[model samples]
Target: MIQVDRLTKRYGSFKAVDGITFSVGRGEIVGLLGPNGAGKTTTMRVLTTFLGPTSGRATLAGHDVLDEPLEVRRRVGYLPENVPLYLEMRVREYLLYRAKLKDVPRSRRRAAIHEVITRCRLGDVEDRILGHLSKGFRQRVGLAEAMVHDPDILILDEPTAGLDPIQIREVRALIRELGDRHTILLSTHIMSEVEAVCGRVIIIAKGKIAVDDRLDRLRSESSIVLEARGPADAIRRGLESVPGVEHVVQAKVEGDYAAFEIHTKNGSDLREELAQRVLQNGWPLRQLDIRRTTLEDRFIQAVTRETISAEAEREAV
Candidate 1:
């Protein structure tokens, strides 16, 4: 229910988001991941109508973010990294106030506030002051405020930023539950969170879209790890000769045994062939396994590739 095409946001001469385009279908939970200052927050702000794009276009639920900002706001609920809250107000009181501000009808405001309080697990602390609540509870209060109006889309930036492990798990579970009803675009530094709750991942680097793919498909990419004893050069040559083997790089050596990571073409598994080659060469095989690619691996690879490309462009100039 969100569409962004060639979106760019700039401050003076610095571009925070540069010509990036992507979309999130209805009820889809997509993770927006990147390193610090990589434009993740900038992109969310633009989508939420808190900041306008310098160029390009974005629409939420068929409403243009620039031309129809009020309509876009009505459909989007935003929970920024540092949630704006009234610490003096009680939890339920704060949510009630937010509902009114979001234009919840006077008749329905009470019901909306109550529903979000229950969903966000603020039943016990609904009467407690926001400032008196713990970090975790305060976060829940922020989430309740965002949902007070029952928006169709939720744009959350660092929903689990400062919470402890238990609180993080709680927030992750809540986000997963919310995905069933709302189209969510989440930004966070935690890879495991994305792996846990997000079906798809869009990784940004250097103000550009680096990788966008399904989590299962990205994890399907794999490589082989081999460790054996005999002659390092011979083992390397034998592995390089195997069909589908893309590159063989020596990982480390411990006495006579050496470890080599075998990168393969098309995510191929060559453990059996590598093992047979080791047996034919009279090498004592110690380890043979397939190492599946992880979200973190893909993230680092994409960011590294972007950095390398930027360096090359500078060098060419």
Candidate 2:
């Protein structure tokens, strides 16, 4: 339901976002991940029609973001990082105002206000003045205002920033619940939050796309970490004979039992072979599973690899 093709943005002499391209289907949750100053916010603004792209094009649900921006805005809900909140208004009042501005019919404004308040967990404080609410509540209030019009798509830029662990979880649950009915574009540096809610990831770096793939597919394709428990000496000796096992390390454990990880070649599956070896040796196997690397590792690997590759290309010139 979202399409960005060769989108670029520049500020004076600096290129904030350079030729990034990707798309998100209906009901899909796509994550935009990168370090600070990686142009994630720039991309979001362009897609939201808050800012015009220097070049290229984007569309939301068949509406051109540049030529038909009003239509795009009508279908897309955006929660910026700073969450332009009006402190003087009560929670429900502020949402009602935004709902009206989004062109919600007079008949639907009250229902829209109540729906977002309930969906965003602002029920208890719906009558509370926004300025008096906690930082967590204020963030949700921002989210509520963004969704007051009940748009088909939601683009959240760091929606959980400055919130406690409890608030983070609450925000995550809300995002997942929203995704069931709306296409979501989640932008955050918090790997755990992305891990918890996002189905696919689009990593941006140096104003370019790094990786875009499903979470499970990314880990399954790269490196699968295997943790095995058995006789230290025998397991070590036997694993060395197993083809495709590149590196093996005996991990330190509390008890006498030995634990080790088998790092194998890419796209290799060594579980069955290792299992047979453990049975053949009559060793008690404690644990055997292919542990994939965390999203953090994958993110770091993707960004670092791109940086080094860019440097190598420059040096070659």
Candidate 3:
């Protein structure tokens, strides 16, 4: 479990993280989803005690990040955005070295190294030189290094960045496997990666927490996209009569058929009502559906709204 309260971080006149607060439960995987310059990495640094906050506090698994830095470090495994790796050493050698560095007691170092090597699926390159490994392999080594200490909390920053489709799936699988046993705070700019790996998402913009919610909840707030092949006029009139249906637009045109999108409350499912309405109106329904907005859509919509709101405030001055 981790808790961050009113955490603020400043550099001169600029703030990197502004009064943000959130909590992560034991074995829960939460994502920090945002664009570049959103201060996600800066906030993660503060959580891991790599950088002190300008104000407020962050405690990981109940150990104050500032008061008990060493303890927090021991309990947290951090894979920074730009993973620091020593390529000169063999894959296994580098991990063993980091295991020791993380103070994985000398007695347990051998097993710890082996545990992470296997956990991160670094078998083929275990004996190969780190410099000789592919980008995917190097990423595995970096992940292995993070797990060397057997920490309970894993904070991975863009762990799947630059990986190909197959490689990304493998890494995502590894993260999910780890999530079963560790509390996870995943930070990434890749929307698909977050959607594939994270259960909850936290959006940060302009050095502040904009929104934090379950992925499912965020999508529920997006516009509903629907498709129906029927007499356009009847379909539109019946759909318009439905309460909570704010607006409907023809999204696509395919000969005699058409695609319609209904913007409703948080993209709520309106197909059943739409079906009934179309039936009563005697308009043959071809497609009445609500497409679940993806994490990408939700992220863009939510973050853009926040940025626009903030900009408007400044412009109003």
| Top candidate when judged by TM-score against the true structure | 1
lDDT of 3 by residue, 1-317 (tens): 89999999999978888899999988789999889999999999998998999999899988998899999999999988677787788887888778877888899988888888889888777999877888887888888888889898999988988889899899999999999889999998887777788889898988778778897676566555555667777667778899778888877867667678888865667767777777786666676655666777777767888789878978997
C-alpha lDDT of candidate 1 relative to the true structure: 0.92
Better model by lDDT, 1 or 3? 1
- Model 2 residue 56 CA deviation (Å) reads 1.2
| Residue pairs whose backbone atoms clash in candidate 1 | none
**Which of the numbered candidates is closest to the native, going by highest lDDT?**
1
In model 1, where is the ten-residue run with the lowest total lDDT?
A: 92-101
What TM-score would every model get versus the actual structure?
0.91, 0.81, 0.82
Better of 1 and 2 by TM-score: 1
Span of 10 residues, lowest total lDDT, candidate 3: 219-228
What is the per-residue lDDT of model 1 for residues 1-317, given as tens digits with 9 covering 90 to 100? 99999999999988899999999999999999999998999999999998999999999999999999999999889999988888999988888778888999999988898899899999999999888889999888888888888999999999999999999999999999999899999998789989989999999998999999999999999888899997788889999999999999999988999899999999887789889999998999999998998999999999999989878977998
Q: For model 1, what is the error of residue 42's alpha carbon versus the real structure, in angstroms, after optimal superposition?
A: 0.7
